[model samples]
Target chain A: MTEPAAPIVILDKSQMAENIGAVARVMANFGLSELRLVSPRDGWPQERAWATASGADWVLDGVRVFGSVAEAVADLQTVFATTARSRETRQPVRTPREAARILYDDRASGLGVGLLFGGERAGLETSDIALTQGIVTIPIDPRHQSLNLAQAVAINAYEWRTLILDAPPPRFREAEPPAPGQLLLGMYEHLEAELDAGGFFHPPEKRPSMVQNLRVMLGRAGFTEQEVATFRGVITALSKGRGRVLAKLAAAKRQD
Target chain B: MTEPAAPIVILDKSQMAENIGAVARVMANFGLSELRLVSPRDGWPQERAWATASGADWVLDGVRVFGSVAEAVADLQTVFATTARSRETRQPVRTPREAARILYDDRASGLGVGLLFGGERAGLETSDIALTQGIVTIPIDPRHQSLNLAQAVAINAYEWRTLILDAPPPRFREAEPPAPGQLLLGMYEHLEAELDAGGFFHPPEKRPSMVQNLRVMLGRAGFTEQEVATFRGVITALSKGRGRVLAKLAAAKRQD
Candidate 1:
């Protein structure tokens, strides 16, 4: 099954056409698909902005224009307003990753998420800031409160990607990073088989702490499934150099 | 009284000279004194940088050169690392105000504060981030994390000024703002005097709640001592004008 649709990005009362393109460029870099422009200045899909967007023309081509922030985010079950300053109103303040995780998790449960950015000169008004459940504050020099809109998006998108895209659930590609869990299981099997073959558990006295130490070392190494399988193969090949019977025994240690 | 010695700003290996000048402009806007360049690309004091800095050449003139972050911050007791990204390291994360408060308080208590900015593309290295005892993260648009270096410095300097200069201080001034404790005490006296004369705390039964409300209102308003004294004078004058009290109070509140 396909993963959830990409979250919608909404820009409210955006004053700079170049910033719009920059935002599109950052979104495209992160593989985001949709852009919602709310009351853009100098009009939407401006040639200057498109030129600045570099290769992110698809964002301009597919942009949906709305009259207001509320209209732009009406379909979103979750919304994040980005600002340089915090407000008196309290909402759950979270780092971008936590927010991204909440959004990613909710997406699977059939909720749409939207991130809202405001005008370059003034930023989101009080009413606009209040509309979202939380604000994303970027840490910058205290002397300058303004940020280019596109840069703001890239940081958040980076955090989200780190949380969500870094670890895809178990699946086989022709050649891909092995899953961590599968790798652990393979390593455990390999260790147990190698130990059995080497009379590692002969007296049964060496079974407990030796196996535990091996497990701990492997855990510390953080080997992936592919790594574990690769290691297991290496172990089997080494055992085969000693004898075929031992190699067969090592092969039998495959977890699945 | 003349303001304290001008503090120094150190930018470590900043990638863009334009950004350096932009940061210089922002620093100049806030009355910061020095711009120290550490391993900048294209070298410092470039003509383009000066052009971008507008009229902030004083920022460039006071510029100091250093090879590394340690050398730059050695004389300073406190240093703050400004980064948009979070690290696995354990540097205490603080808002720019909080960090600035620490620096300003230290300065007030006799210590120097040095601020560090990293390269434009990669940001401050982990070692650099680790060198500082704390971090200041800017809140911004999550999908686009592209703040120019000068913009980042500007925000930090603004926040530092907010903390070190005065609470509710003027935006542009070379003079020092009143100290925090003095300002707080002044506001309290103003509130008490205003409430005492205006019949605001009248009727013994309503005195406690009325006084409590007065304190809460002023507290919520974040009035600096000077602002509170100004309000107190207005209140006392309005009390003298029996018929015009409402109009005077309305006018005063409107201005705020």
Candidate 2:
């Protein structure tokens, strides 16, 4: 039935309401709905969160709050903590992509899975991390290990969406198929006639090889019909531009 | 010796300095150093870019400016255009993961690889996209096809890094290795004793089965030493609170 992804995104002690808004926007971008806030600093229902959410009001409106990280994730069967540094804990750590892979399988099994993101300053404390089975650590500049809060959440959300939905490779169904060989030959002839009239066949002996090369190049491209028409329009523009240049040159000669 | 993994990151007519700075930061995160600015809106050496880059000064310092996309990617052996919408072009379209897989091979063969990121508003013109061999379209929210510019670059860089570096699975060195069965049993004994003293085993007959279930759950978790310690701490806190409540009841009886 293509159920929308419903993994709980638990934000622990998040400091900035604006960043919370950004997170909601990113989560919506990936179709993740469940949001749980644990001990937000400025308290819940911050107007700043709604203001910065842009069009992701649904995520903010449906959020649940909890007093502690343990209670926040009590219902989830699988949980992951995102921390910038490798901590001394039992849980396994995975890159965002790897974590998404595991989350995809766990979600398919109908067991609730959630991701825990720490506050703006220091990330998840060891006690909070101990509750989760795994950690998701994004590879960042070691010298500067922090990413903006929303960027961190955005990467994970993007990974999860990409894996589960399996977006189709791009195709242009609207485009008419490439021009037939015969029709392409006709285009070549027309373009060649125009070029020849414009004295493009200079040093006449080289003209045959040049024309043959041009034909081969066009054939290799397998240009679509619309593209061929566009090229024809370019030729028309060039011809009109040339006519204007010729008239200007004739006027100058007459004045001399 | 490991070569500095270099790929030309080309931003085609990017409008915002903040986006340019962000692109540079993401490129640096993946060890991609080459930056080619193709017709940026505010011209070059933007002070705002340096402010947003955080510590990616190297990318900004080595940036090269070009008048067009063609000029930007001229020296590269392979090029990819990242666009959200499907375009009618001869170029093959690949997911970022797929493109990274191909680029990984091409880069190993010593062929320079490059990516083209379009402007903030409309994406790369089809003519610009046609210059590349492949298109990388992130499967985004169909309704919200466009992504913040820096985000697109970050996802691609992550894929490339994961492929090349073989990021290690996270491990914690000091967690006393998953607690031995004997130690886990000891934790169970300590917690159950505390709970019994607090009358948590209420209606007494059901207590044994509930304890068994708790033991099974903890066993399934493969609790580590640190985690067990944390659970024990929670048990201690609850038991102490119960002792206080009992003392309060005795004190009230004496007052009566």
Candidate 3:
């Protein structure tokens, strides 16, 4: 049996009753029922929607109306804004299926989960995206990324359904994802040790600038701790044969 | 050995060129080579679309242009119009997999096949639907049937290429689909013989109009010669013992 979650849908200023109904139908198709409409243009219980919904009348009838997306997702601990656009955000962006797995696991521990979708025309506003813990973007051709509201919802819902209904074990669990702060700290320590050993920071005047450049290079590399550790191993191996040779050269240069 | 069908894609007044590029990328994703544009709304080979299409520039470069659906399908004998909506027409409605099977079979016999998708918002119009020999509707949720234009094309193209690329066999012999005129002639002869034997044209004056009405009915059945033969076998079995079943039916109706 598939385990159900506290899956709440948050639609922000959506248009098209037929589409909303279609969303309802899709949600029902995937065994999801909780719909939270945020300021829809077409009011609830639309007749045109009923015809288009085919057999998902329960979803339309059970839809929860909300004044704002935040309010719609107020009860949820983890919320993801569904968008195809890459915006300037500090939060993580997860694929729909990945989000579903996290949400499903969280729900087993009694955590409320919510997914927010933009309106029919333009997707969720910047503020709307900002409200979520993370963003969920569908991997599509970058050129034609304008997915309709219902289509976006369907993709997300399909991911959730695949996770819940499929009832299969996960393929692989990767080691814990590294935190940004942990990666940056490791990079800084690595650069400091390499500079000390190389004597590249000998002239105090050039040391700050050289260190800054090294910092920029290391940052650009986005080195994970494991990668930085690999670089450290390479430095250790080279030092075994060439450390004294380089030090003698540096002393001769200073004498000149 | 899988026989490759002549590449054809029919777009109905597509609003976005980027979406066309996206569709092109998806075509390339499944190794489809030909692209056909039908009355594009944003015109052909938009540069932004090409940039978005990433590695699928070849598809855009080789895109064939057409003025209308009929023009696009001019050379295709077995065309499938993809729509989420079910209309009143009696055309065979199939899933993408089923349509792929038919197209692959047709291709083996040297027949041209086209898969048509309509505009982003409304989908295929009735006239566009009429141009197709059958309909291929994706098995989406009964409540929420929301597949975007490129996504729709991608699903069909994916099914098509998968069928061809995965363990293609040489069992089925493909032949050209029979023309409507040929089908009509086959139906006409079969019904004429059955009705003549059953004494359905009792009054000589009513015989001409009766035969015409029967033609109209069989025509509406969209009968191929094979289907007509099956119908003929059904009527022959029903009327074997009765010398004048039509006359007996008329007398029974008069008594009532």
In order, candidate lDDTs are 0.62, 0.70, 0.66
Q: What TM-score, to 2 decimals, does candidate 3 have?
A: 0.37
DockQ values per model: 0.01, 0.01, 0.01
Model 1: per-residue Cα lDDT over B1-256, one tens digit each: 3344445688988777788788889998877878788888887557887888898888887788888876676556556788876544334456777776666655554456677888888888765554454578888798998887878888888876665556432223122222233343444455555445433444669765544433322332223334445444433332333324334444555655
Model 2 has an lDDT value of: 0.70
lDDT of 2 at A188: 68
As a whole number from 0 to 100, the lDDT of residue B60 in candidate 1 is 83
Q: Compute the lDDT of residue B130 as modeled in candidate 1.
A: 47
> Which residue runs of candidate 2 sit more than 4 Å off their true CA positions?
A1-174, A188-212, A229-256, B1-5, B13-18, B38-54, B66-71, B74-78, B88-92, B101-113, B121-134, B162-256
In candidate 3, what are the lDDT values of residues B1-46, reduced to their tens digit? 4357634777888888878888888888887868888888877757
User: What's the residue-level lDDT of B77 in candidate 2?
Assistant: 51
Model 1 spans > 4 angstroms off: A168-256, B1-256
How is the predicted docking of candidate 2 categorized under the CAPRI scheme?
A: incorrect
Every model's TM-score: 0.34, 0.38, 0.37
The A-chain TM-scores of all the candidates are 0.62, 0.63, 0.63
Best model number under DockQ: 2
Note each model's CA RMSD in angstroms.
29.0, 36.5, 33.7
